[model samples]
Target: MKSLQLLSFLLLSYIIIPANTDGGKKKEALESQSQHTRTKKDQQNFATKFRLYTDATKEDCQIFYNQLETLDKCSFNASLPLVIIVHGWSVDGILEGWIWKMAAALKSQRKQINVIVADWLVSAHQHYPIAVQNTRYIGQEIADFLEWLEESIQFSRSNAHLIGYSLGAHVSGFAGSFISGTNKIGRITGLDAAGPLFEGMSPTDRLSPDDANFVDAIHTFTKQHMGLSVGIKQPVAHFDFYPNGGTFQPGCHIMHVYNHIAEYGITGIAQTVKCAHERSVHLFIDSLLHNDKQSTAYWCNDIHTFNKGMCLSCRKNRCNTLGYNIREERLPKSRRLFLKTRARMPFKVYHYQFKIHFINEIPGKRIEPTFTMSLTGTKEDAKNLPITLAESINGNKTYSFLITLDTDIGEVIMIKLKWEGTAVWENLWDTVQIIMPWTKGTRRPGLIVKTIKVKAGETQQKATFCSQSIDNLHLYPAQEKTFVRCEDRFQGQNRK
Candidate 1:
C-alpha cells in the first residue's frame, strides 16, 4: 500500500509542474506582444526621423539633436500645415524634444500641421554675421523648394507658417521675406526679439523689418523691456512674452535656477516638444486649411504701459494705472520746457523731474556727453529734434535738463536717454522713463514728471521720445463688455 501511494504522488507532481511552466511561458509571450503593439502604434501615428548633413560637425548638442529625431511629427488629415522652425544663438539643434512636444500638442487638436525641424548649424559660436547669412541661405533654399512643391505636389505656401525662436526667429524673418512663391506666407512669430540693440536706433542699426514683407504678423519677447522705438510698427506682434519679467526665468535665485532646469533642461525640453507637436498638429492645420486670420494674443503689463497705444493688442487690455494712452486734445502744446507747474484742473495731475548728473570716481577726468533724437516714419522723413542743455561741468560735475511733455488723456509720456562718455567704465546710456508723481492727486496742476533709468549700458548719443497715442478708448468694451471682465481678469503681477 505504501509503494502504491508514493508512485501516485510522483505522478501528480509531474503533471502540475509542467502545467505551471507552460502557463508562465504564455504570460511572458503576451507581455512582449503588448510592448510591440504600443511601439508599432506610436510609429504609425507619428513619423520621427533624424537626418544629419554629410558635413555636419560634432558638438556638445549633438546628443540633443539625436534625441530630437525621436520626437513624433504629429499630423492631421495625413496632410498637415508646414512649420519651419529655426533655433536661437548658441543653441544646438539637439534639443528638439520641446519643439516636437509643442507640435504634437497642436496636432492632437487639428491634425493637419506638418513640422520641419531645421538644424541649420552644427556649432555654437560668436559668428553673428555668419549665423545671419546661414539662415538667409536656408530661407532661400526653402523658397526654391516651395516653388517646386507648388508645381509638382500642388502645395500652397500661403498656408505655411514660420516660427523662429530667438536668433532662429531673426533668421526666419530673413528667409521668409526673400522666398519667391505665392504670397501664402501669412505669419512670422518672433519669440522674444533679443538685444537692447533695437533701442532708439534706426533700421540701419540692425536688420530692418523690410527684409521680410511676407510676414503679416509678429510677436516679440524681450528680456529687459517690451516695445521699441523702431521695427515693424503696423500689425505689431501680439503682447510680447515677459515670462518672468524678461529675465532668463522668473522668481528668486533658487526658483530661477530651477526654471532653467525645467526650461532648458531635459525635462523642460520634453514638455516643450509636446507643446510644439500639439500646436503644430492641431491649431496650425485648422488655421492653414480653413484660412483663418485670427491668432492667439499675449501681452505684458509693462509693454502695454510702456507702448500705450503703439501696441494695438495692449491697448485692448484696459490697464490705465501704468501710464495709459494719450489723447492729442488733452496734451499741452509745449514749445516751453519746465520742471513743475502747480494748478487745479478737472483731470488728475502729477509732476516729476530727474536731474541729469555725472559723478566721476577718478580725481580729474573730463566726460562730455552728447545727445541726439531722430524720428523716421513713412509719413515723414527722419527729423532731428534738438535737446536743450541745462548745465555741464568738466570732471565730477552734475548737469540737469528739463524737457516738458504734457500728459495726453489716457497716455503717459515716455523718453529714451542715451549718453556717451570718454571713459572705459560700464553702465552709461541706459533707458529711462518719465515718472509722474501726480497720478494719485484728485485735482492738481500740470503733471510733474521725472526720468528714471531702467537699464545698465555704456552712454551713447541719443534719447528717444518713444511715446504712445490714445485715440480710441471704448473699442473692446463696445464689442463685449461682460466678457471683457471675465476674460481679462488679473491673475497676478506680470512684468518684463
Candidate 2:
C-alpha cells in the first residue's frame, strides 16, 4: 500500500510540473511581446518634439512634453509671447533649412519672444497621405504640450501664436481646436495651407476662423494640377490673402527651373517645383525682416474685381497688412483679400489702374494702337511701361487696365503716352484724311485721349492727368503726348 501511494505521487508530480513549466514559458513570451508594443507606441507618441529658440541660446534647445524641467533648461520665458512654427510634409526625414531660418528671423525681430519649432519629421517623412494623417496625432501632442505649459508655468494661451505651413497649418488648427473657451490660441497664421483632403471640407474639418481667435491664411500656390491644388483655394480663415491671384507666382515659371539649378545645383529641382508654395514662408519671413515695408492686401469679392482695381479702398477695414503685421480684427464672415507681389523679396508692389477715354475722330473706325506710358511721381519716374489693351479703342469709350510697379513712385505728377501703329496702318490713315477732304473737318483719324484717371492701390490716392496742350492730345502713330496732373474730372465721369 505504501509503494502504490508513492508511485501515484511521483507520476502526478511529473505530469503537473511539466505542464506548469510550459504555461510559464508561454506567459513570459506574451508579456515580452506586449512590453515591446507598449515601448514602440510610447516612442511614436514622443516623436513629435519641440525646439526652443531664444536670444539667450545660440543653438536651439530641445523641449520634451510633460517635462517641466526642460522648459527651464531651454530658457523659455512665460512672460514673453510665444511663436510656434510648425512645418509640413517632408520627403526626407531631415528638417528643412527654412525651420532654422524662420526661427532666427523671429528671434531677431523680438529678442524677448519665444520661438518654438514643432518637429514631427519622424512621421512627416512618409507618403503624403500618411504624413497628412499624422498631423492630427502630432497636433494632439502639441496641444498636450501646451496644456502642460499652461498648467506648469501658468502660461497664457492668448500669448501663443501659431505659424504653420502647408499640412502643418491644419495641424495648428487641430491644436487650436483642442483648447476651448478662454484658453483658445490667440492667432494662427496659415502659410499656404495644404489643400488635398481639406479643400472642400467643413470649417470644423479644416483650418477655419473658429480654430483660433484670429486666423489668417496666405495662399500662394492654389493653382490646380492633376485636379488637385497644392494650396487651399477656399478661404479657410478670418483673413485669407491670395497673393498674385493665388495662382502661378511671378517668378515660378518653368523657365526659372534652369535659373534655380544654376544657383542651387541638383537641389534646385525641388526648389523650382515648390517655389510658389514655399513663397508663403518667405513672405512671412519678409514681413519680419521688413516690417516697415509690409505687404498690404485689399478686401475684394473676388480676384476679378480686385484686378479691375476697384477694391483699393482702405475704408472700414477693407485693407489689411499681410503676414506678421496682419490686423487681428475678426469679422462675422471670412474676408478674401487680394494683392500683387513681385518676383523677389520685398514682394510688395504698387497697383495702378489707368482709365483713358479715347475719342476716335474718324467715323465708324476703331483703332488698335500700342501704348507706351510713363508716370512721373513725387519720388521717381517709371518710364517705358507698356500698356496692353485687350480690344481696339472705340469712339466715346473708356478703357480701364491694371498695371503694377515694383517701386513706389509716390504721388503722380505727370504722365507720358506714346502711340505705336504699323507703318501700313499709319500711311493708310494719312491717305484717307488727305483724299477725303470733302468728308468732315480737317481732324485726322486719331485717338483723342482727354484724361487719364489713375488710382494708386497702396496709398488709395486718385488723380487725373490731362494733356499739356489739347491740340497735342490727338494721338497718331509714332506720336507721343505729355500729360500733367489736372483738376479731378473723374468724379463725375463714368468709370468701369
Candidate 3:
C-alpha cells in the first residue's frame, strides 16, 4: 500500500512539476490551451530549432529554418556526415544536459562530422497529450529543414544519421516518411522510444524499420504499469536490442530512488523513474567511448532460452554489436537480440556458457549439490562465482548454464569447482547408510565429471576442460576439484 501511495505521489508530482525547475512558465503555457480544442495559432507556437556543433565550433551555433545565412555562419559542411540528435518530451521548455554531452561526444569521436541537436521543447513542454499530438508537426518541420538544406547547398540525405530518444524517435520516423524514395536518410537509431500512445500502433504511426535505410533500437525500460509501458515493448527497428531483458536494469532499484532523491532533492524523484529509460542513452555513449570494449548482443527467441546458455552461438548473423559499431544487416524480418550489461558506465561484460555432464556411481542415485566456481585465465582470475542449477543432477545428464564475469579474464585456462552439501541432506544420507547393510561397505554416493565444455560470447571461442587428475575425478560433498584446458571430445563419448 505504501508503494502504491508513493507511486501515486510521484506520478502527481511528475505532472505538476516539469523535469527541470522552469515549470512556472511551462505550466502557464499548458494551462492556456483550451481543454476541448487547440487553436492552429496555439499549435504553431511550438516551433522547432536546430543547433549545430562541429570541430571548429565546440559550442553550439543556432541554425534557423529556411535561413541559408545561418548555416554559413555555423560553418555547416555538406561534404561530411551529418548526425542529428533529437530528444523526447520535456515538461520544461529547455533541452536536457545530455543533449550537450552527446553533441560533445560526437564531435570528439569524429573530427569530420556535423552534429545537430533538434530542439522541440516548445511543443514538448505542453501537456503530454498535446505534446504527443505535436510530434507529426515537429517531424514535418524537420523534413522541411532537410529538404531546404538539399536544395540550397546540394546536400545529400544519404549522409544524414538521425539519433532520437523517446518521442523524438518517432519524430525521426515521421521525418523519414515525409522524405522517401531515392533520398532516404542513411540510418535511424531509436533510444528507448516512447510507448504511451504509440504502442500497438501501425508501422506508419511509430518508429519502424522503414523509417530509414537501416533502423535499430535499444530498449532499456519496458516494464508495464497500469497496462502501459514507459518504453515501446514491440520491435521498432531492424535490430531491437533488449539489454538485461528490457524490463528492469541492474542498478535502478527502489533503493536507488532514495539515492537520487538525496542527490537532486525533489527533482531526483523524476530521475528515479528515468534512470532505466535513460540507460539507452548511456549505452550508446559507452559504445562511442569504449571502441575496444564494445558489447556484443546475440539473437535469441526469448530471454528464457538465453538465460539457459542456449543462444550464445554467433553463426550466420546470430550476434552483433550493441550500439554505434553495430553491423547493418537488413533482413526481411526484424531481429531481436539480448545481452547483459553492468550497472555503470563501460557496461561491457564477458559472457560464457558452461556445459558439464555428471555421472552417478550408484544406480538411480541423484544429488542436489550447490556449486561455486573460480576461473583462471591468461589475463586475470575471477574468484568464487556462484553457479545456480534449475534442477537436481541426474546420472549421465548434461546441464548447461550461463555465467558472466565483469572483467575480461582473457582465455580461460583453468576452473576450480567446489561442492557444498546441505546439512539436512547429509544427515539423511547417514541414516540411510546405517539402514542398508549392503551400502555400509560400498563407496558413498559420488558424481564423476570428466570433462566440461565452454563457449565465449564476445570472441566466439570454444574450449574443452578435463579433470586435472583422472584418478581423483570423483566429486563428493564438501570437496573441491580443478579442471584445465585439454583436447577432448565431449559429444557421443561414454562417461567412465
Candidate 4:
C-alpha cells in the first residue's frame, strides 16, 4: 500500500509538472495511446524507483536518493560509503537493475557501502562530440549537485567513487574535472572510454587530471571500428581492463554475441533492480583504493608526489605515453606498390590493368591494380620483373596480371589503369615523368609507384611494395603484424 501511494504521487508529479510543454503533450499522448506500450515488467520497474525521484531524466541526480531509498526499503544500514554506477553511450537506464544485483552481493557482506545508479538519455548513432557536449553539461550539473549535497544533504566527496562505462567514462572524467572546481575527485574508473573521439584528439580537447587529482581508467577495449577513427590511444584510460584481450565479450563469434546479450542485456538489467544502489563494484574499488593509498589522498600532499609516490602512478604514466606524431619530409600516407622505378628514361612509362564487372546497378563492382611511388638508387634493371597481382583468388569472376618495362634510374613511369568487364587480360599503362634524383645530392634514383584497383562483385584488394630500405619500408604501413609493448605510461621506445 505504501509503495502504491508513493508511485501514484510520483506519477502525478510527472503528469502535473510538464502539463504545458510539448514534452507534456507527448507524455499525455503516449499515455493515452498506450494500448500495450510498456510491459508489466516496466511498470514494476518504474514503481521500484519512483519513490526516490519524480523525474526520470534526472536519474543521475536522484541516484543518491535512490540509494537511500533502497537501504530503507530493503532495511539496510545507511552509514556506508556510496558507489555510483555510470552507464555508456547508446545504453538505456535498464542497466541500473544489473548494478543493483552486484551491489546487493557486496552489501550482503559489507553493509558499510551503498549503491547509486546513475543514468541519462544519450542519442543513439550520434558522434563523439555530441556525446561530449552533453556529458560536459551533465558533469557541471553533477558538480553543482554535489556541492549542494555537501552543503545540505551532508555527502562528502571523499565517500564517493564513480565507475563510468564507455562514453560514460569520458563523461565521468569530464564531471570530475569540473567538480574539482578546485581539483578533487575521489576515484574514477573508466570501463572502456569511447574510442574514436579520443583517438586523434588531444587531452586538452577532452577531460583530464590536470583539472582534477583523482582520475584513473580501466579500458575494457580501446578500438571503435564504427567511429571516425578506428584506434584509441592507450593513456586515455589509466588502468585499462583487458578482459579477453580488451574486446567485446570474448569467445567464438556466436558465443561472444550470446554473452553480451545475456551479460549486458538480461543479467545486467536484473542486477541493477536487485542492487538499485551502489551495485557490486565496491569490493574492487576498495582493493584499488587500498593498493593506491597515495592517489586516494588529497592532491596537496608532498608524499603523494610523482612516480612511485602517486596513487594512480600507472595512469599517470599512461597519460604521458599517449599521442602519435608524424614527421614531415617523410611519407605521410601508406600504400601498396606494384612497380619499382630506379633508372632514368626519356618517354613516360605506364603499366596498369582493370577488369570492370556489374557497373550498371545501384552498386558497381570492378577489379583493378593498386600502385605506389618510391625513389631508389639501387643497381637493379627495370625489366621483366614479376608484376605480382592477387595471388590465387577464389571466385572465377576474379582477375590478375603483370607487366615489365625497360627503363633506368632517374626516369618517369606513368601507370594508367582502367577496368572494363569484357575480357580476362586488360593491359593498361601509366603516364610518365622525368626522374633526376641522382643528378642532385639525393638518396635514390628509383621511384616505386603503388596503387590499388577496387571493383564491384569482388572483395577489396591492395597491391604491396617490396624492396630493402629500412627507412623506405618504414615509410609506409607495414604489411605484417607489429606491436610494441611499453609501460602504460609513454616511456619506452616503440618497437615495430
Deviation of model 2 at 479, angstroms = 1.0
Cα shift from native, residue 21, model 3 (Å): 22
Worst 10 residues of 3 by lDDT: 29-38
State the displacement of the C-alpha of residue 3, model 3, in Å, after optimal TM-score superposition.
4.7
lDDT of 1 at 332: 19
Model 3, 156-252: lDDT tens digits are 8878889999989988988887773566888999999988778888887788998888999999988776657778989999999999989868887
Off by over 4 Å in 4: 1-79, 91-93, 122-129, 180-183, 210-212, 224-233, 247-249, 252-496
lDDT of 2 by residue, 268-356 (tens): 66666578888999999998888778898998887877776768878999999998988899899999999999988989888887888
Candidate 3 has a TM-score of: 0.89
Instruction: Rate residue 14 of model 4 by lDDT.
Output: 34
Cα lDDT tens digits, model 1, 108-198, are 5344555555555552122433343344444444454445445545567665656665455555555555555436354555543323223
lDDT of 4 by residue, 1-496 (tens): 3442332234223323333343434333222111213332332222112112212232222333224444345432234565556665442334544345444444443546655555555431233334444555455445554554465556676566666665666666665766644536566655545554455555544444442334554333332323321113354533332322223222112223344447767544322221211211332333333322111111112211211112212222221110010011111221111111111211112222322111111112233333332222133334213333443222223233423233323222222222222222221111111222223343322222222221111111222222223233111111221111112221131111
Candidate 2: worst 10 consecutive residues by lDDT?
29-38
Best candidate, lDDT: 3
TM-score of each: 0.36, 0.87, 0.89, 0.37
Q: What are the lDDT scores of the predictions, listed in order?
A: 0.32, 0.80, 0.81, 0.34
Of candidates 4 and 1, the better by lDDT: 4
